[model samples]
Target chain A: MNWMTTIFYFFGAITVLSALGILFTRNVLHATFLLMLSFFSVAGIYVLGNASFIGVTQLLIYVGGILILMVFGLMLTTKLNGKALVTENHNRLIGVLLGTVFFSILSYIIIFSANFEMLKSNKTLPENAVEFIGINLMSNYLIPFEIAAILLLVALIGAAVISEKRKEKQE
Target chain B: MSTIIFFLPFILIYTIFAVYGERKISAFIQDRYGPMEVGKYGWYQTVADLLKLIQKEDIVPKKASKKLFLIAPVIIFTSIFCGFVVLPITSSWEGTLTQNGVYFLLAIVSLDVVGILMAGWGANSKYSLLGALRSVAQIISYEIPVTLSVLCVIMISQSLNLQEISYQQGILINAFPDMENVKNYLFGISALNIDVTNWGGVFTWNIFRAPVLIPVFIIYFISTLAESNRAPFDLPEAESELVAGFHTEYSGFRWAIIMLSEYGMMLLVALLGVILFLGSWNTPLPNIGNIMLANWTTGEPETIAGNLWSVFWLLSKALMWIAVQMWVRWTYPRLRIDQLMSLSWKYLTPFAMFLIFVSGLWRLLMI
Candidate 1:
């Protein structure tokens, strides 16, 4: 395989491995960090696909922003021992059957997809992709950015109120 | 100039220097010498710290999740390093071997939020978790102002590419012989600009040409401090209360990673200050020849010397901003988490929005 193929395979393997690790990890905190690793390696896939902007965004939003929030949530809400947050499934047989079927379907899709030789080398950052998003965000899609801000604002206030509810309740 | 080639070492050196400088400056300000025993006035203190950290045994507490513990510091280090990929150092220098440099940097900055969170979780420490959560909230909340202020800059510059933005800035518009007589492309011989004090003398720095840059300057600098998780916004890692904050559980090399990453980020943000607000590599005025002939050579940058001079000018400008950050770090006390959030969401965001609106209006009015 060419160097490009090797790198691609490496990132892909890492991504898949991290994802599986997240799924299997019983420890809640461990799982969240694993999830972080999983998300980052997928971002690596985006980088390989020449979507560095999206890749970085994926890293920023998922790995940096979202994962941190999730970990914090896990840590704050859980007991001193982070491993105590485990919820063992009583229906292990059904869970295993369902997991196996899902894995089978996923593997079948991946195997078929691999046969297509979909990889094509394009070195230069495709112009209209990265700059165009920023342009569209400012010009055409300005309303969306504004709207997203508003949604975030509402969520912030809601989260704040919920956290502060105990103070009101006690008073 | 060769994109990644110029700034890769700079990122490493800046990170190393920031830690070294923070200690040295802090000690100096506090009336004591700091870490001088390590290496030449503590020049290699951070390096010694790194060696010590690496040699020290790794600790995974019995309560900690082993896998996540292994993963957390790597997460922190990897994500912060990503930011260097997009930094435009000089007018020519880009850290990444690509365009869409701004996007890359923005993405990388965003990733630090995750690192803090992961560190908290993986350690399974209460204080670490608290620090992590607070950080995530603080960073997310502050992101609004940061984005809005950057938006103001992007709107003014009309490009997202860091190199292009700096290159356009590097132009010595006032250096042109008939610069004063030159008509605006959008506006006619319009109302002669109010503040042309520097026009006759200082030549074409960004401040004079883009008046919006001044408020954008204030808003941008404040937002940069918040973005870098520097004091007063450093509530998440309040040294007094949080017990070393989010990376509290980290010892040895893990702790080193966190410290180095923080400094690297400080330098990155400072570099952004120089590139965005200050006339990056471009001298405040271009026509030093005129100044030299008139025996006023002090005002003009030393472009007559060589490329080395321009590099010096660029580094000097960047260092000035870094010093400002250092000063701010020393001067301010940490804010409360609530205070930090309110400052970003309530105050800074609205101000940035208003500034952007006014700037856009002002630009249109000029036309």
Candidate 2:
């Protein structure tokens, strides 16, 4: 159909396919890379939705920063032998049944929702959405921003303490 | 779109010359003649090397993952190519001036880490994996200071658009005294004060905007060195230890593509430095070649002449920075991995953060 619709579908397909690949891929490293692909495709979807700041932030923070750390942790902590690494999971039948039920419930709720029609509107964001975000973050969202900042600082100090304790134990 | 088409050849030819220039500079630093046999003053040395690389057989290691091995260079090259889309060659010249131009550029540039990781993992070698890990760590660590420094500039400009930032840098600080007496030169081609005199343009660049920004610019440049994996911070491909590092298993055309992407990245960093701090495409001289162009044109010669001058200045500035990178590479010894990490996280990051705070106050007070 239209260019926007086409782009939306393309990114949506990539996101879904890569997410599925992440679940199905036996190799842990491959799964991590697949997760990166999923994140990237979702970022592409965000770009298509005209929220470029959100899109780029997703790319910069998640794909670039967090994903690399995850990969490093996975590779260093786990050892891969000569044979292809395979992931083994138990309770497959119960897992599938639970997944199906959860999906159906979500779909049913989405279908019955009164505000579902809101998705049909192709309303665009303001051109200066970044500036708007900044203003909102400083004013209306100031409390949430401060909370997030404090939470992050606490996490940092917690990590430092844990590492220091571990070093002392090692010594 | 036309800019992409126009820039394609320019990027290729420029990469070739850059490689050649790097070789000659390195040789000069080492006090030896480089590539003397290939052509006069080694002009065709890179050309010959390119031909050799093209003719060489593509080799994929037996244990390597075929798909990832083949695709890694493509991903790296594509990421670098995408970054060029936002680079403003002149104030008036850019490919796509997206709303968040610099953010998008940085995002795409960071994607190269993914490609490097792919290359390292697909090769199925310990050395390759180690190199990739080091590179990813280096890039991520340096990115904090780099981004913080860029944020300082963004805070001052209050815009994410690269072209807007460039335009903001066009105002001459020295010309403040003459603002009342200076003639207005809007688009109407009226007599305007010579605010763009080379000396004034130098003073107007963001690096010179405030005393705090000078340190920020230095941090940014140091981070750029780390981000691009240049010498002193080039632990990723430390030849003395890892034997070509992440690209240990690559050969022939694929290796050439990786090299091309590396040079492309160097160019990207240089161009970004120009835009962020050096004032993209702004001529140093206030009234550049106005007298020379006046005799040939019936209409006002400002637009055409100005753009032409801007392009010349921008290219020269970017190229000069590239040479400086080469100089730094030859001058410094490589740092230890631990030292590299400390340089970024322990030093640059905190300094950059403090500078950002100071810059915010500076802007508030100045405004």
For this target, which candidate reaches the highest DockQ against the unseen true structure? Answer: 2
Give fnat of each prediction, in order.
Answer: 0.69, 0.54
Error of 2 at A161 (Å): 2.9
Candidate 1 local lDDT, A1-171, one digit each (tens) = 998778888888887887787767676766776787678778878887788778878876786667766766776677654335875557889988998999999999998766544445435656547667867899999998999999999998998898874644553
Candidate 2 residue pairs in clash (backbone atoms < 3 Å)? B196-B285, B196-B286, B197-B286, B198-B284, B198-B285
How many steric overlaps does candidate 1 have?
1
Q: Which ten residues in a row have the lowest lDDT in candidate 2 chain B?
A: B292-301
- TM for every model, in the order presented, reads 0.78, 0.88
Candidate 1 lDDT by residue in tens digits, B138-254: 777777777777777777665666655554454333443334443232211136654332332223344544676687778778877877778877877887888877888878877
> Candidate 2, B187: how far from true, in Å?
26
Candidate 1 chain A: worst-modelled 10 consecutive residues by lDDT:
A116-125
Which stretches of candidate 2 lie above 4 Å from their native place? A78-83, A114-123, A165-171, B1-3, B171-200, B287-303
Shift of residue B40 alpha carbon in model 1, Å? 8.1
For model 2, residues B1-367, the per-residue Cα lDDT tens digits are: 2256655777888888988988888877876554654578877777888889899999999988888888999998888888888766654566673579999888778888888988988898889999998998888788788889989888876778887776656542222322324322221122333233223354456665545677787888889999889997899999989998899999899999899888888888888888888867654433334442322211112367656766777789899998999999989999999999998888999998888888887676433
